[model samples]
Target: MFDIVKQWKWYDWAMLLLRMVACISLILTFIELRDQFTLALWVVVLWELAAFSVPWLCLLLNHKAYWVTETVISGGISIYLTSIFPAAYLSFIVPAFLMAANSSGIAYRWTGPVTIVLIPLLIKLYAPSTNLILMMVHVALAFAFGFAFHLLMVNHRQNEIIRTQNTVLEQYLSQVERVTLLEERERLSKELHDTMGHTYTAVIMGLESLRSTAADAAAQHKLSDLLELTRTSLDEIRGYLHELDSPQEQLPLVQSLRQAAEEFGRNAGVKVGLRVLGDEYQISRQAKMTFYRCLQESLTNSVRHGHATRMDVLLQFELQQTRLEIQDNGRGTARIQEGFGLSAMKERASRLQGQVSIHSDSEEGTVVTCSLPRALKPADDVIKLMLVDNEPFVRDSLGMILESERDFEVVGRAEHGLDAVNMCEELQPHLILMDLEMPVMDGITATQSIKQRWPSIKVVILTTFEQKGKAVQAMRSGADGYLLKTMEPRELAEHIRIVIRGGTLMDPSISAKLFEGDASDFLEEKTVIAPLDTSAPESSPLRVLYDLTPREMEILQHLSKGMRYKSIAMKLYLSDGTVRNYASALYAKMGVRNREEAIEAANKAGLI
Candidate 1:
């Protein structure tokens, strides 16, 4: 592509060559004229050389500059030459071509008249008196024919150049289109993984926090079962997002994550390891990577936050599904909030129609497990998983969601939070998922009691209350994660596999909101930027209501109940935009002009 443009550098020479063609015919005429006049051959060569050389003067001027002055000089010289070399009738063709090629349709009409006068003058000089009239007719025919050829050649070459240029432009545009599609896919993938991912983490945290218990050995056994389901949910999320990232970023989910982990470990001066347990395991690209990214977050939590010294990765495959397990010997948090690690893992698993589970405790440290279907998880014989959720709806929803995933086994379900936690310990299950608000006991209170005795168990949360303030509280209480009930159930299964590997889930949107005061996240700081919105407050009152998302409007209603932007971003999972583009869009739709007027308009339209 580059070479084509480079080689065509001398764009003007093509036109110059056309003029040369005209000159060549004239040169022939001059030679014949010398014979008719009985002149020296040197004189003939000299006259013709001067005629051909004259056009080079046009090259000294810009494309259209000094045209009148150049034409006068050229025509006068041609007339003088014609008087000298009337077989210059051939010579006259030179100027004839110049005018035909350079001038447009009507003005170029003169070339015929000009050729007629010059051709006869030359014929009179070259032909015998008896033959003069007949020879003159031949000269007229030659001039007319030459002028017609020139007309076609000039326009044909012009179209050829245009066609070549269009071809090059089309290729460039095609490449740009390809790049744009790739970028859009990447952006969407990032958005999904970051935003909804956190909601899952919060939900997981709610469930994981309740794993601990002080009941009898059977109750302890039940708690262990809950942990198994919790750990596998993340792998499912990675498998789902893998599809979104591929064909665009051109990076496989597993490979990109493995490389990222190696880089992080190297950069942090920590030893992070990746292990594949299922020899013939295959999961969707998203499932593989979600587990991988979850590993990064879990290890990061271990080293930077968990303050652990070692981490382990376990991958298992079955004929129908695959399972991932990550664990570490570190002080485990009971509650997992909307942190980046668990959140992103949950999102990826959801996309793959998988599930995630998280388990943590002071004794056994922290464990994250993820499971995926062979269809969605990418490997036949992936691994077996025990399901735990008190609500039949939640359990059935999870089972149906994970039905497409291979290598995963539902094993059994626990009807109560306490029963789920008790079953986890007794079964010593690979993964566990517990609902926070279950009968007999809650997930958070149970996780604390279970982790005190057995730290190796992995538990994931699938709960409703995990959505808000309860999430942070659940984490502190002893849960490894807090994943939402609203997640596509597959995500809950995938994260469980990753948690089994001792990995962590990272949700991007949650991370963005974690630090409320950082300048780097300018648009994210609603309170800081909201004060700036004070600029329009004096001028635009009552319309500010349109700026909020429906969730934010709910938050606004809460603010009407007295809530704030921070609460709204938390509630809706939005990064506070400086100039709310959505608010502007809402304005036009709601028939208000700006944020202030929008509130009034919404009221008028009964939207409030």
Candidate 2:
């Protein structure tokens, strides 16, 4: 009860104080009327005591009924006191003010006028000599003050609600931006790890091979040095790969911050102190980065700009947010200019719905503070997965890579596409990592069948092939994504999650091939463009007279050869639906209704 009272606002205390004053006035009135201790006097005393007790009851119960009881008892007591003592009309003021303050809606608006009129009339009826005008004026003034206070409280509550909503919105936007940034970073990391790592390993191997072939002592010595340097470079690349991975299980924030402080102090030859307050809790990867960057920037600024020799760092983990404060005992300047480093630190913090504030003074030195909202940990809902590959080694390797992530559970495995389809029915996995050239049934055919049976099950083709035609075929056959086996294991796991989240992904190299807009790449044999004049008039009967894309022209030629839709799909390395769509567009452009009309029109044009 004491703690609840401590949490009460200023208005609550003010209302309580006002009620106490009214109760004290009633006690004094009772003392003055004690000489006539009759039934009426006893009745007045009881009424006053009930009015006093009602507000306290309302406070204890916190119910609308108690509040209504208080309001009624107080009004009745005020009216009786005013009627009997006449000069005791001052007691009416508190109840009128409380009525306006406590009530809302229709009651709030009408209570003031009713109290001002009704009380004065009752006073006039009982004590004809009482000053009714003065009583009305006092009641009106109390009501005005109470109504004004009520409006202020209402506005304050509205502002608080708006502030809470804005904070939530900012956090949501920041989370979205962080996810996008992390995905792009993962993509770049995967590219660097797979491409550069392989290239470096190959270089090292070639250098080692050359070392054995070198002739003479000097040549051998040079080869040995070159090989060593290449090895060193490869080791550095591997180190970078480790950093880029940024595994989910990282050191806690305190340990990370302590290590950073120690390293900075050792490198800069400055003394650093660290302090932590409150219990520690886990934070997101983006938040960790923000905190780290802010610390680095602050330390750098303290040494470079402030010419500081010693630094103090404080990390506080609060319920709402985690805060980091860095104070430097250095010669501070009067005005601080925000340079690129500070701007970058601010930008990074803002991206995670956090803030960084820096204060500097000549005497007080400099203090940099960063605050980030605590992120809630995601629930562990693991994705049920199955792997399908012809080779046992490939299936095992793929399973190992995917199972490293806690969110993925490899439920089953299959050596061939036929078995994959059969096991999928039994396992009912959420996703499948399938190889393209599997035995019995190909991945494209299996993907089509799975989508036909269970449209919700996502199938991603993971293979060494980067051919655009294969990727197109897989997508046409209802594969959710097409990826290369060269991708980093972690990146592959992330991509699987993306596919399950309704995203369609393709390897960057494959996407680039599709973007080239070359129709010849899709065909097994390139066809020569017909020698029809492209500058012919629109009225010309030749199909070339109508403007058509290169791909459209190729499809038109295929159609002119009396090929079926399935045959055209095979020849052009496309799906039947793709061929039909191209044919439909070609007919629309040539103003022909059907395939027979299109072929007849093409024959008359002398281009076939």
Candidate 3:
């Protein structure tokens, strides 16, 4: 009740004040007419009281019935007051009738017009001496003013709603930008740690070896100085890495939660209590980060929207799962319209195979519960890889580099594509790095064969060539990733990890080449077409003249080139479902029933 009052606008206060004045005036009028009070006069007083009090009762209960009931009662009171003292009480009754006509919540559409017409007629009927024409003019004026005021209030409400939507959109966009920037930062930090850290370690090892081989004191002293400087530089890089870490990564999940709660309490002047239950266990970095972000978002919502004064946080570690609950003593809402904050919280939790649930009420406040699984993959589970290349030096170098990383194990090495395929049945590696040009069988055919036989196995084409056509063909053959031999060894390992995590990777230069041209130009270059058949039907030219969008034309070209829907979707950066929808629409437009018919139509029209 207090929350509703707090949300009232200025006009609400003004209307309330006007209602108060009308009630006071009616009370004084009754007191003055007590000596001449009749049954009609007593009835008028009771009706006025009921009419005024009903609106308040309806508002508190949030009843939809208030609109019709209030309109009827207000109309009745207006007629009674006017009939009792036509000229004397015109001011009070006019406002009452207008208020009913301009009510924001009028369930019955006919109520406003009925109130307008009936009140003037009653005035003329009760006071026969009153001028009918003048009263009719007054009714018209009252309706005009009432309708204008209603429109103004409607416009104001719509503007408020738009403003609120804009605010939410802005917040969501800002959060996306921040998330993108953070991800880029994390990537750079990792790249630096992997590449530069290894390089530094290699340099230190070389300097020590050289120093031991030195026979002169001067050379030894200089080498020692250089070694000291290199060590200091490595220490500085470590410091920068620490600074680049996100706040959530700086401490354990529990300590981070406590610190965040304490800091928020101190700044927002809200009381926050945190409790832990059961023995804590180690969680993945991603899960820890998700938990931290959810807590921060919940705290912001409780204070910003719920206007909470006190919050209670509970962390429980179960045998199979970890749970976090947040409760707030705030003015909770009956309906929860999830805005960006709540939606983002859910998204974060879901990414880590977790779930978030919220329950809210006007009296009991809001409770948010987030649960994540405790059974996460161990850190030492290495990715079993198979190296495939005809060149011995290439295979050996890649094997040496990958073996240096604890997370990668080269389970098998093959000299060619056919050998790799034969080895896969025995090795059953998690990932196979294959070269494009190999003896007996090429990489693309090998990849397609392996994928057809064992779809679970991932294949990445690692080659020296940067040809766009080869990359497209490799992807069409179900290659998980494509990269050049020029990529840093550490970066290659990271890319392998990415592929293992169900993400696709492409060399940036090749990606640019694949997506460079406009739709028509790209289709013309990538799609092959046979010379126009002079022997075919002449009506085919008419079929080719049918109107088609650039996207539809592009899709048709792809279909004619023997590319599957999944391959088209990957090339176009669209979902499989979206590609299917486009194909359906294209079929409808082109008067075709399926992919085969569409391709035949395009070929006859010389579109491919």
What are the clashing pairs of model 2? none
Clashes of each: 200, 0, 0
RMSD of each: 20.7, 20.8, 14.2
Task: Write model 2 residue lDDT over 180-297, tens digit each, in one string.
Answer: 5655666686677567655665575567667778778898898888878877886786667567654322667788789878866765667789999898876765577678667766
RMSD of 2: 20.8
Q: Each prediction's TM-score against the native? A: 0.34, 0.41, 0.48
| lDDT of each candidate versus the true structure | 0.53, 0.72, 0.72
Q: What would the per-residue lDDT of candidate 3 be over residues 41-147, giving only the tens digit for each residue? A: 66767777877778656755554555555556765565555566666425434454445434656532554555456656766777676666676566556656666
* Residue 163, candidate 1: alpha-carbon lDDT: 64
Give the residue spans of candidate 2 off by over 4 A.
1-6, 37-43, 59-67, 156-191, 209-226, 239-250, 253-608
Q: Whose TM-score is greatest here?
A: 3
* Candidate ordering by TM-score (highest first): 3, 2, 1
